[model samples]
Target: MSEHDVEELKGVFDVLSSQIPALIRGIIASVFSEEAGREMGKAAGAFYKGLIEAGIPNDVAIRMTENYISVFTNLGEIMKKLSYKMEREGKIKKEAEEEKGEEEAGERAEEQ
Candidate 1:
């Protein structure tokens, strides 16, 4: 190939190499930002419509919202702890069963 074609190919390669990851990052960030914005908008609209429009005091609404969020966060923490406990219990049960099986096998071997 001619030097001019080689140079053109290098230019294209350089652009793709530099731009592809940047484009991907931009797209990912845009998607995440859009979704987050949509969620916040929906939450805000619901709060405004339900509480603020219903003539609830703005300070009361804010406090209620914070309390509501705290409740959910606490619930989430409780659920997480329960989930971990269940998982540990499951693992312990499995290990105990395995040990029992090993002990039974050992007794059979001794009998033989």
Candidate 2:
């Protein structure tokens, strides 16, 4: 890609690098906060109770409850992974741009 294209890409990545982290942090905090924890516990208990009332076996009810809780945890994990990957990609792009700039400067110096 041309230098101008790379620079534009760098700007986009920089914006994403900042915004994505803030979004991820907000999501993670909300998911794991004390209020969220309490709500999750209540919800899981209600699910388990409902299953038991419906004549589901104790083991099955427990498993379902575990799965229900996993949904929230999984969301948090996915966001964390996405944030890490974006951060890593941004760093890689920045490093590549820096290296290309150095190479161009060196070539100019040799021609002078």
What lDDT would each prediction earn against the true structure? 0.67, 0.89
The ten-residue window of minimal lDDT in model 1 covers 23-32
Q: What TM-score against the true fold does each predicted structure earn?
A: 0.57, 0.77
Runs in model 2 deviating more than 4 A are: 1-9
Please report how far candidate 1 places residue 94 from its true position, in Å.
0.8
lDDT score, candidate 1: 0.67
Q: Which residues of candidate 1, in runs, are more than 4 Å off?
A: 1-41
Task: Please give the distance, in angstroms, between residue 36's alpha carbon in candidate 2 and its true position after superposition.
Answer: 1.3
For model 1, residues 1-112, the per-residue Cα lDDT tens digits are 9999997986786565555545545544553476755875677568656898889999888887777555644654555555556556656655786899999999999999
In model 2, which range of ten residues has the least summed lDDT? 85-94
